[model samples]
Target: MTTTATDLRAQAERHLRALVGRDDATLYDDQWAAIAALVEDKRRALVVQRTGWGKSAVYFVATALLREQGAGPTVILSPLLALMRNQIEAAERAGIHAVTINSTNSEQWAEVHAHIRAGEVDVLLVSPERLNNPGFRDEVLPRLTESAGLLVIDEAHCISDWGHDFRPDYRRIRQMLAELPGGIPVLATTATANARVTGDVAEQLAVHGGEGGSEARKLAPQPTVARPAPQPQEDVLVLRGPLDRESLSLAVLELSRPEERLAWLADHLGELAGSGIIYTLTVAASQDIAGYLRERGHEVAAYSGQTETTERLALEQDLLAGRLKALVATSALGMGFDATLGFVVNVGAPASPVAYYQQVGRAGRGLPDGARASVILLPAREDRDIWAYFASLAFPAEQHVRTALKVLSDSDRPMSTATLETYVDLSRNRLEMMLKVLDVDGAVRRVQGGWTATGQDWVYEQERYDRVAAARRDEQAAMLEYIATSECRMRFLREALDDPEAQDCGRCDNCGGFTVAASVSDAAVQRAGDRLTRPGVALAPRKLWPTALANLGLDLKGKIAGAEEGRVVARLTDLGLGQALRDLFRPGTPDQEVPVPLVQGVVAALADWRPRPDGLVAFESRTHPLLVDSLAHGLSRHLGVPVLGRVAIRDDSVAPGQGATNSAQRVAAVSRRAVLQTEPVAGRRILLVDDLVASGWSMTLAAHWLRAEGAEAVLPLALASET
Candidate 1:
């Protein structure tokens, strides 16, 4: 029953044929070399290759060879569910049994675990977050480490802080590596790592079997693995190849306005080569773009992190089956797929060239020779502001980190994130990321109760954080430069990624003598303008008071009954009137009467509002009394409704300051200042007017008091809503 080299090669070829459904399927030199290192030499390897460079083939072929030699299952640390599903499908085609453990598959974990224990699974896939799970880490990881034939880290750039999409959970892979038995043969693969990230990842991979030596010392929050002094450089093979994509034709289309950009997409989308992706910067943008495209009679769906898991699965299937033209998506649709994507259109500039390369790399992958795919970047002026907003959420200041740790240290019991927010000034997303980093660095522990401090002496690396911040700033500058550059676009990107073989791509817009049309039809532009300018975002009434307000000494606990629903003429972040509203509400600017255009829009909205108001009441604004009074009087004059008095602030000490504090704090601030000043509304429908609605607490409190005073109904209206 012994298997010879010839037999192994034959079996690999068979699997390759099955995977592609072609007899000519074969592996390139680097792919075969990676497979040999894993299956024959049993050494750890890092393959930093471009998309469609057969990185997956290396691991799959190696897995098939190892399984024939009676090695245990291969465990891959995949980043996204989309990736896991794609891997599973590919594995099945190769006749390999594969299963996944992720948030979406919780119902089947018990069965999957049973199958793994029973030795019926050949490959198992898991997300990085799963490594820190209380149950999986304590129960299953130990067994998997001992039995896994080969460990794979897909999208391995995520392990490096320098990576565009760094994940703290991916760092836990080092601990897993330390526990893995010698000669297990690990493989880490990525398509977007530059020289710096490549080096960082290579050192982490070498942490196994004492091979890291001093190179491992180069990493931060150093691996938790206790190693006997640095040994010789391990057989860590780093196979970095050229990242040039011959089948990709790159172009940048600069539009003057957001609406114009949408119009151009409406005009050019159908003309693109095949089914592809339309990448947007935010969830709102994705939804907005999808709605517009659908109205234009194109079949598209919005795919984002906000998308439900089942819906995401369905969308993925539809995209793969070509039932839909494209998915207007945020970065939530992580750049991972095996589809023969023919085009990719980025609606806004990504913050960095590295990220841009990764996104556009999704297209033209695995295309037939001489077949090209289009990659377009529709640059917008708003992209820089969006980039700055995202950059603001990077790792917190040392003082902030220390504040969180000190609070955890002083707590008697485990505290949930919601409770911790009452103490920390950071946003929920930033705090959770910090906690995860701290947990992995041995500064804290997450248990069933909640999170508890571990009291580990964690040193805040100020220099490292500063360097990362500087790199990010440089990347942003580079992106802006890319937009203005006349040099070859692909060459600039490849050089930015430190691709040694970088060269001018003759197929790009610059070298190829082509330019994306800057003109959009007048009709298309008008339709886009109409959609953008159309206002009135529904302001859902607050159903329940924020939880645990009692701990903050507030009497409020349950849902606020009889909460009046409301609407704003526009969001301060809206596409059309946002800038105008933002300018009007800018701090330190003198208050003026309501602008004519905004008044017109508001009047238009009120004309269509359900149940016309019988009276108007102004909410006193300590900062903008003139603006508030003017708006109320204008509404009264325009609609011929009687002007009832204002909701007077009880005292000077109660105005909620301009900055966004938490919901509970805002509500608490409002309760003391918002006093019902006028006579009881008494069975008459009333309109509550305000200059701006930040947290909606002021309106909520006002409505509650008016309803209590026997008002028939309260309809809240605002000039602008700050999200």
Candidate 2:
């Protein structure tokens, strides 16, 4: 009288057939195993497989099966909007009504909620950030937690701090998993988790729901309740398999400079198999490469975090339709951008092989029979510097966390992020991330207004962070080794993800297969070099003082009247001249006369000015006094202008490198220290010169000093800028 395993498999295959819009469709053996674990045992499972391995079909089929068994709707915590779009369509094809409530769709929420209450929705999708939304967390999520048929965490590697693309919001999934009712079917899925990340996520998945879990409610902002302790729970069923795609061919093209990399891409993009993505490590690189490629007659666009959502959608559609050769993108184009992409070219190597695997998986997913896809890497020497810059944004130091917790614990009312920013010196994004992590750690909570400490005895977990950082360094070393490895290229990447069945792919460049020509024509190199060498960066002056300067013992606020338009030879993050500037400004580089090429770059910038400066003033750099002074005097002589003297450091207590911190601290350090000592500060348009203008506060406050001393106007110039 009982339904057999064969019966369940038949039912699952029917669901799959409906999902894929064909009667002959069937789940892979691994996919069927994942679905059976969820539907039969009501167990928690973690599925780590390669991309295009039918991870989504497992869930959609299980959703249809569970819905038909009289369970409530399945709940999926997807990481990207693009993934939600893909899944909703797939669910409908299986005759399972699906709905989503995310940032992009507010107008449909009431209707969607009505459908859910009416039992018309079979699956519901939301981003991890929505899990912590004050309204959604308090109102909508609690209901879904208690009654959901199945819980799915897509892109599950993000939940681990050790993962390359760790997001604070994904950590909320741990707490959510702890709050889910026991015996409910749960699934966590990712395509790029290594052994360490896989173990971390699996450990979190075994935690059972607590009876009296803490709430993220807005209180009177006094003391708050501690987060609930997790109880002992069941084991997680882990299904991991070989991470190899037969359709992909991997190769590394080592070039010495950015221009060579750009030239290689330009000379060979058309020769690539089909439309795909070109990944970069920074937004500046994405924009610069996109611009150069467009000039070379490639129909391409740059995509990054700064890109508008609507425009990203349009670009994705264009790339899908093959109207564009590729998108020059930062990591923003990653994680759930499903297309039948034919190639993925790395402009610069990613930080880890795990991340590189995820990016390259985007290619060859939808290729036709027996046709292989290309995945190329063009690594540069600047990669480690860029990596270090991102590493600095990791969890704040112990003291910073103690300060923030103290402020939150003492406050009478919930402080908004802006108000908290006046006290914490961390940047806004980093501060918010720290708070989210703390909230998950039970040290803090994000309430209606902003954040509040939970009064728990929170410890910094220094050893764990150190291990994570060390793992990151290992991954970086591995990535470098990947470029130099004489072994099979695909096998190297597969083993990087800890694939047990990794084997020689036998078709990579090292395996005697053909790769694109590493050599570029001199004409192409010359054109790329010309684009990189031409450099003039507009520097917008600061217009207002940062808020709550009094807290830092300064009285400045409101409109900053003395600041004006400025120029720089180029940004230090620029594609072409950036390396030259970065080298000259390296930490131990000697202070000396400016290089002739840099001097020429400054001259080219000045030639386009409307009103040339009559005088030049240098910021007496504690680190590079000779360089700053020489550049200022050299420009003065070239323009036949007067030398007005230097802005001396009045308060040596304010370190020269303080300007690299957050805005409030940067302004605080310089506001009281910059003293214009020149005798000829009156009735002259002074050209302010410095070694760099990283945060603009140094120039703003120095110009404030000059304007305070009755200078008519100020125009700033720097050898390099970072903003």
Candidate 3:
């Protein structure tokens, strides 16, 4: 029954052949080393290699060998469900039974669990988020970890807060690892980690047995005592390989304008070797670019977190099967599979060099006819601004954390996120991420009802957080430097990733002296310009009052009785005129008559507006009140409508400033201020105007007051929406 090293190799070779469905398939040197370390030595391994490196092969083959030696199933933690789908198929090809439990497959979890208990499932893939799922963590995880023969952490860079894909959920893996039965082999793999991230991940992975993760890190808040010297860390076998790939030809097309970038995609997207990806920084940008490309006769689709799971899967398949020329996507379409991905075009530079490398790694994975992928970055001036926007969402201040902790600690019962928002000042996503970190820190616990405090001592690691923020800023600067660099593009990225074997690939545009057509067609530019300039976004009414408003002492709940959809001239995030409009609303802009161009846009909007307003009522602005006055009066003359009057807000000194503050707080702040000083709106459809709409509450409450005052209909309209 003893399995020798030679015997393990023979079995692995057979599994590899079956997995790849190639008769002569053999393991790469790194793959074999990783496999041997896990299957033979029973050591944790970290495999840092480029995409298409067959990292999966190492785990699958090792699974087969380990199972033959009477080990239990391997549990693979994958980032994306799309990746899980591919992994399952690949495991099936190797005759290994694999099942996934994720958000999309909740209906099948029962069946999967039964299969696992029956020993029919040889491998199980799960999302990292599942580690913190109250039910899964309390019930399923303990049993799974007790019997797990091997643990595979895919996209392992996500474990490092310093990595481009740093996921708060992935941090819980350390807790899972701590409780995992000793001698269960663990394998963590990623294609996009630099030395800093690599060391960070390795250190986390080396948390010896039951005392896991950082001894005590950021994410938690309260107070902590100084710990004694840490014990020696466990040894993790590190398998790192050169990042460069022969199949990828890196390039940069420096088109400074959004129009030129869209033009470039439209002009040459079809000529790209096969279906691929077009990355944008925002969901709106993805949708916008996809629509523009389709108009230009290229078949593409937008993929983002906003895309439904079913639609995302369909779009992913279309790109993989060549039904789509590309999927214009946000980072949400993370690491989807495509055997013939011939290119990866970045509409704007990624926020970091590692992010750029990770995104570009999606291309040239495996191309038919040996066609090299065109990895290009079309960076715009707005890219830095976009990067800063994302950067601003990093860790909140200690005071913000303390505020949320106070709210939770005082609550006797678990509070849902929406309810918590009534007291906390953080946005939904940020609050949830903070809670997850706190959950790991034992400061709070998410249960069946919602989330409750544990009163466990937690320390906010200020020094560590400061370092992380500094690192993030450095990455952004490096991203800027990446686009500005005239040297070898691939070398720049590889070096940025701290790939020890970094060298000029000799295929990048800079090294090969290959210049792609940088000039955009005038007609294309004009069309793109038109598309960017013609802006109007539907402003959705805030239908439901935020839950637990009682906590805020407002007593508002349920759906608002009367709400109607409205329109804005543009979103604050939109390109073209939106940029100009945004500048006008910034902290120090002059309060004068709104520009003629914007006035013309508003006039055009008014011309198309239905249920024509009998009169205009401008909402008082907290900033740039003159602009609103000018816009309202100018529209009044243009529409030949009477000015009803102005609406004023009862000032609340405690109102939080508009930033990343939550909806509940916005509602709380605005609810105090709806004082109608306007003319009677009885029997008339009133036009509710504002300088800009953010959070929609200002409009919501204002419109409600008008409707309550007997307006037939309150039609909310704004110059821009901060969507």
Candidate 4:
């Protein structure tokens, strides 16, 4: 009853044909050819392709070929919940026994464990986070070892920080694999990875064999020791002509103000006549803008990290079904979302060029002509400042490496903030901003417990830190050079990432001759200076003060005796400011008297006040002086704003980017009306604010309740950077 090699091969081919609906003789492309060669050679291989380039097909074909040769079930370590679900669904449709194990299902986990042990599954898909579970490694993976398994790590780039989708759990997969007794052949596949990332994957897998080793060994050489083969001229495929996506057109509009940006987006969506995506930077912002759009009669959907998975799936299905015409989402929507969106709009500049590219890429999926994409630049000076800061940090440097290490080592526990002043020599504010960049690269963890170190697997030996630091410095310098060059932005991005043969993408700003002007008028510059000098201007501090001192329940004298009340007022004005001063004043109440009055004034000025249309009222008194201190410090240097007194107001009625918009005066009429309408609830108004807002959902929701309860005006404000 045993199957022979020929029988197995024939059966596997038939199964694959039925699954893929393609014939082998249909002429494979170069990517497929390369994959087939690796499978034929029977070696471990790492394949890196571009997004949407059929990487899964290569791996699936390889899987079939290997299984025919007597390899056991395939184990795919994926990092995304959506991706795992999609793979499981695909497997089921193809008649393959595939199961995904994660934290979602508590009751069925035991059954899944039993299935793995009994070898009833052909594919076991799991997340890197799930892989860390002790039960999975001790009970499940060990049992699979009896059958030689094909271990495939999808989104393998998560192992390296240079990759866009970095995950700390992915970094540990190498050790996880090593713990298993059998030398199961590992295949790591990703759509994007630079030279460093590719190398890191090989080293972590311990697949380093010299160039002369087995094909797998050659393909999966140690990243540190491996020298990339000279890129073949013919191997470079260039789709360099003007992308005449007749279905898509490119446009850029200058928005005069923040409100105007929202208006423009709403109008654009109305005119789009098809499904669209509006990419923003925060969940609150997405919700706010989506609400506004929905109010304006657009079928809008909002997607963010806080969104429930079931809701997200429902939204996606709606988008596909043409029931939802527009979606307002954070960057979280781009990875592996298979919607046929007709347009993509970025409300502001993306954090990185790669991020910008990825967001825009989401629009053109499966389009006959291709989808349109645009970026609407607002009139906010802060947007330009943010872009400049991003540009400066875009290039890696030795200082960044040092800062990263200090952040990692100085943390009392695993913390993600690399910019903590006590831990690094760099300015704390600068470090704080740079942390976002690192987070995007999967270099740090962002969790509610606090920022924790996530990507430890990519960290080389401390002894080699200097060497790696130096190499990174060079790489960053190259990136900087590319950014400054007048060549096509696409070309520059490719060159910066060591892409072998990047050609001009005629659709980009550079190729399309849409350069942002590099000159500032004296009048405009002087106006900026005058705005900076305005009273009540908010400022960001240069560095972050110690959290311990801020948390202490004492007066100002407790922390620093003889500190001027005015100095403290100007220094601390955000949510935690008064609390920090109060902590300093705890033991000595006498010293607290001076600080208490001064701190009270600062807190009151910064305190959030809102009035609803129905005689309802809301007040917030949680001012953190450090928040404003840091912002003021940063703004003073950049905007030359001589901020005398700063306050962190927690009002929901004030729209974001409206710091200078006289929110108190503007909301006065609505507040009085609301208070008069609902005298009973006027004394119990609810106010709300957050660290950042892109669309303004939190503000709107607060406003809704304030109006409902007969509260006074519901004011909203937020501290946020442009996209």
lDDT of every predicted structure (CA atoms):
0.82, 0.84, 0.80, 0.48
The best-first sequence of candidates by lDDT reads: 2, 1, 3, 4
lDDT of 4 at 554: 15
For model 3, residues 378-425, the per-residue Cα lDDT tens digits are 887777667777877887778888888888888888888888887777
In terms of lDDT, the best-performing candidate is: 2
Taking the tens digit of each residue's C-alpha lDDT, what string does model 1 give over 1-723? 876766767777777777667899887778877887899889989998888788888888789889988999999999988888988999898889999999888999999999999999999999999987878877888789789999999999898888888887887787676557887999999999888787777777777636542233233336332222223245688888998988888999888887898899898889887889999887767887899889999999999999999999999899888898999998877657778888999998999999999888889876788999999999876677678778888878898789889989999999887777666666667778888888777787788767898787888877777777888899999999988898998889888888999988898898874456777999999998777767676777887876667766777768786447787888776656665786788677888888887887787667666648889889888788787888899889888888887888886775456213456656666776677788658898888888888778788878888888888888899989876
- Enumerate residue pairs that collide in model 2: none
| Residue 579, candidate 1: C-alpha displacement in angstroms | 3.7
TM-score of each: 0.91, 0.93, 0.95, 0.56
Worst 10 residues of 2 by lDDT: 218-227
lDDT of 4 by residue, 1-723 (tens): 866545544555565565556576222354445344445444456766555455555556556666656667788887766667666665665567788777666678789878866767778777776644446544666566546457778877677645555554564465444444434566677655666666666556553323223332222212222223322123112111122223333344554444556655555555554687887655645766676667667898889877887897788778778898877887667655655677777665454454444455566555664444433232222234334443454323456555565566466675533224334434344455445434433355445434555544343334443543454445544534433455665565554445677666676554674433223344434433232221121322112223432213311112211101111232111112322433443334332122343334333434422112112122222333344344334433433423322222445454333321112222231232222112344433222322333223223333444445544434332333122
- Top-TM-score structure, candidate number: 3
Q: What is the C-alpha RMSD of each candidate to the true structure, in Å?
A: 3.9, 3.7, 2.9, 14.1
Please list the residue runs of candidate 4 whose C-alpha ends up more than 4 Å from where it truly belongs after superposition.
Answer: 1-27, 34-39, 68-70, 144-148, 177-183, 206-256, 271-274, 369-489, 508-723
Q: Higher TM-score: candidate 1 or 4?
A: 1
